[model samples]
Target chain A: MKPKSFAYVRPDSVEEAVDLLAQHGEDARIIAGGQSLMAMLNLRLVEPSILVDISQLKELSEIGVRDGAVEVGASVTQARLLAWPELKARAPFIALALPWVGHFQTRNRGTVCGSIAHADPSSELPLSLRLLGGEVVLRSKKGSRKVKAEAFQQGLLTTARRPDELITAVRFPVGVGAEGAGFREVARRHGDFAIVAVGAVKVAGSIRVAVGGVADRPGLLELPAGGSEAERRQAIEDFAWELGGYDDIHASARYRRDLVRRLAPIIISEAA
Target chain B: MRRIERDEIVSVSFELNGKRAAGTAQPRTLLSDFLRQTLGATGTHVGCEHGVCGCCTVMIDGVACRSCLTLAVQVEGRRVETVESLAGDEDRLNALQRAFNKHHALQCGFCTPGILMSFTDYLGRNPKPSEDEVREVLGGHICRCTGYAGLVAAVLDAAREMRGETEPEGEPHAA
Candidate 1:
């Protein structure tokens, strides 16, 4: 099937893109790698009147470590990040999760910001971001604002981003004074969306966890510091309850909950 | 960095199989359609019409990507290698194509072009891949026929040939 005919534009700068988005609103769709949006467009699931191509925006192509955080420009593809020594050193979770995002080819064209913006409950990037306490930088014609990854992801395929805002970049706080970190996921196929994805970062005294694909949004949990094995077991069980999993074609709600119950310890143990 | 107004004609020019090809497409025109309709490069087959099936896979600037998931306009200045890029002359078959024929890696031949384009990129990067790694890459592709036993052999054989190694005498079976 062909996508409905629409206009396409590549803005000279982030501001110009924001103005176009602001002017067009719902009729406009921001396109980066086109890995996700193109699927929707080809299926006619989303038929925007305009597609703003940000892939060529040089301003949004930088990946750097600054002020204790790793900043990835909106146009930076996942494959590029996977090869970046700085990102792997500063934010180890990204390195661990990227290969699981999609196949090698999709990663070549899929942007990190696009993944975060897609906000799929099954997306590995956002699950990792939420666990690491990242921030999304959104710009509008008026100005820019930073929203925590937690607050930005609203629900399934939904985010808090306003219609007029364009995601310019994302900031992930690099784990410091950390003991270890690990990421794991189970998909029917190697590159398919996960049945459940877990990312864990163990710091000086405690374990932090984030889970995706079991609910409308990824769930974050901080287990109590330094507890007995039983206490930790109970803590994980209690945390699992908060996920609000629902039945879907992939797996039942109980199965997803069971995955969290089982995988939580293995990944936490790996990170530890 | 550039601005295009609504419903405006966007001329896209890119290297298609080592030759310059240019076309005008609506923003919605997919690269798969561009190759078939504009350049008459029908060798790159389209299936599933989405990213799930690797039937529309092509080399975009040397990376394997789904042509169905890419707009024709997006190939503006990139190099796209379709299945047509494989063989040099009408009489000669490329090493990969020959290996596929020898190993019986394809049936119905619908999935061959996309698989070839994909491996053209994959085998270049991983000239030596373990069976698991080959299987891992194959996970992205769907093949109802040949069961991939033959495809893996084809890739391994092609890799050896690409490395300038001569095929050992007699019907060679993948070890």
Candidate 2:
């Protein structure tokens, strides 16, 4: 399971990295902690001519609040984000979902922006970002642009990210007053990819529910909080049907829908 | 930035188990392969090189990580610890290893190295972890023998022993 031959470079700055991307275009691939990309490379799923390593770029490793949103740099590892003191107070749902991203071993080397850039349909970070309406910061040699999470993640293993663009950072809105967050996923194993994952956010008498692993991408639904239990279940059921779960080796479409219908309400209650 | 060509073999240097180690690697050489094939530290076994199986786990800068998921060039100038570093004073097992022996945590022994390295890093960070937390960390590894109960017990026992909550039980060499 060896990766195909590829040249490797480590850029000192984000600008240099973007320039490398622009120069190499689709021939070069950006690697952060490489928790996901390395596996893909080993599986021969991708055969990039060159790899740009960004893990050592100090400027791309900061996790701080900027303009009322938590800006996580491209090099910020999942373990570092989980250890961030402001995480629980800022984006609690992300904090809850981070533990389920991968095993402790992978989390030690996986980058937050890398996961979002990978755009795995069943990944927790993208699901949380979508539910929270986060922003993805993409930078090319020409300039930088911010795309909303929903637009950034286009489909399964696909994204709005261009071949010549580098994801410099991601911005997640800070949780404001009286917000509640909860996350739960049913995986065959604890560290494995989720068969069905659900995240819920309660804010200002409204619940935003996000479901992953059942659709082409993580899907989000917003519902008023005044509904009765039966009504809430019906709304969740409707959302599940809307997702149109597909059959895979790990789980069937019916099982995934059943899980969403069953777990969404419990997650909502947990958030409440 | 210096770019190493795909076919070029570059000299890579790093601290392996607290000592300077050097090797040659191509850009695509996995750290697991480098450690075992190039450096000849075969204690870091390779299984399911796609990072699902935890057999290739090792410590990079004191954090547990999948070596299969890491490039050999990435460890340049970084500190890496493998299963070979666990013993001290004439190959005497460490506390965690001793605990595993006491709990009969291995039958095939292929997964033990990775499990040992993982818990070694884990116990250092969480010296007083609960049983559930231990199980959660154990969830990272895939073991076919002993059904993880013995592994879980060993981790908890090792944690207790490391925390000085209990004395070493029986003979140190007993199985």
Candidate 3:
């Protein structure tokens, strides 16, 4: 099946891409790998008048350690991220969930920033990022700004990004002391979107668990460091109640809440 | 009558099967359609249009990708090789292909091209991958007929052959 007709423009630099997006406003879409956007276009879920192909922009395809953190360019593919030695060491959570992103073929073309920008509630990257307190760098013709992962995603498939903005990079802070991370998701089949996914990171004296696919956006719960078993159990119940899962076609809200209550403690215990 | 000004279809020149070729296509046309319809290379099949069914797999810049989902124009100036290009004119199958044939790994042959391309790329990268590693990488390809036992043996056999081991005699077939 052919996609709807749309104008295509390949910009040499991110500045040019941002300008094109600004010119087209909401009618323009920035495409890095075209992994998610192409599928959306084929499904007619979105009809952008112009597709700004930024895949050739080498500046946005880098992975480097800087400022006591690791900054991954928006165009970095999931496959590349999985193979990145530095990222595997610096952010083990990203590594733990990288295999679950998609099949190797899909990961070959899917970009990290594209996944984050899509903000699928069931996606692994967003949930992991939120749990690790990652930040997204948004670029526009006017300037650039950063947003915490927690605040970046407003709802399912919804983000704080504007029509004229492009996600240039995602930064993960260093020094998560004594941190152990775990990512687990239940899906009907391997490589399928998760029915419910959980990413938990335990650092120093605190624990953070981010639940996805059961809520509109990734829901994060913070447990005090070195809590008693009773306190931890109470926190788990309170977090489950706070989630207020939505009933969807995949699973009922009640089932999701129950799973969260059941799985959160296990993940927390493992991390702890 | 209003006339529709045809947008210019960009000419994309790339190396396919070690030969330089060029074609003009719409910006959004997928690589699978370009290969099958435009270039008349039907060896690559499309199973699930989504990326799941690896039937449309092809080597783009030495990496396997689902041609059904990859835009053809994206491969401009890049080298692409399909399953048809795996062997020379002698009709001799590559190690992986020969292993697939000897092990009777394929039932309907619908998923052979993708499986071949993926395994070929895998062996190129890791000639000595463990059994679990093979499963980890090839888990993306689905074969309903063979139940993946024959496919796994084929990969392991190919790995052994690449390591200069002669083909084992009367290899165990899928039970």
For residues A84-143, write the lDDT of model 3, one tens digit per residue.
Answer: 977667887887888988777778878888899989988988887788888999999999
Which residue segments of model 1 deviate by more than 4 Å?
Answer: A176-178, B1-10, B165-175
Highest-scoring model, lDDT: 2
CA-based DockQ, model 1: 0.67
User: For this target, which candidate reaches the highest DockQ against the unseen true structure?
Assistant: 2
Question: What digit string (tens of lDDT, one per residue) describes model 1 on residues B1-175?
Answer: 5555656777889999888999887788899999998878899888888788788899998999889989888889889998888877654567888899888999988888888988888888888777877777777788889899999998888888888787644443442
lDDT of 2 by residue, A82-191 (tens): 99998888878888899999999999999999999998989999998899889999999889999999899998999999999999999998883237888899999898
Instruction: State the lDDT at A190 in candidate 3.
Output: 64
User: In terms of DockQ, which candidate is stronger, 1 or 3?
Assistant: 1
| lDDT (C-alpha) at residue B145 in model 2 | 87
Rank order (by DockQ, best first): 2, 1, 3
Task: List per-candidate RMSD values in Å.
Answer: 2.6, 1.2, 3.5
> Which residue pairs overlap in candidate 2's backbone?
none
Per-residue alpha-carbon lDDT of model 1 for A103-159, expressed as tens digits?
877887899999999999999988877888889999998898999988999999999
lDDT of 3: 0.82
Error of 1 at A119 (Å): 0.4
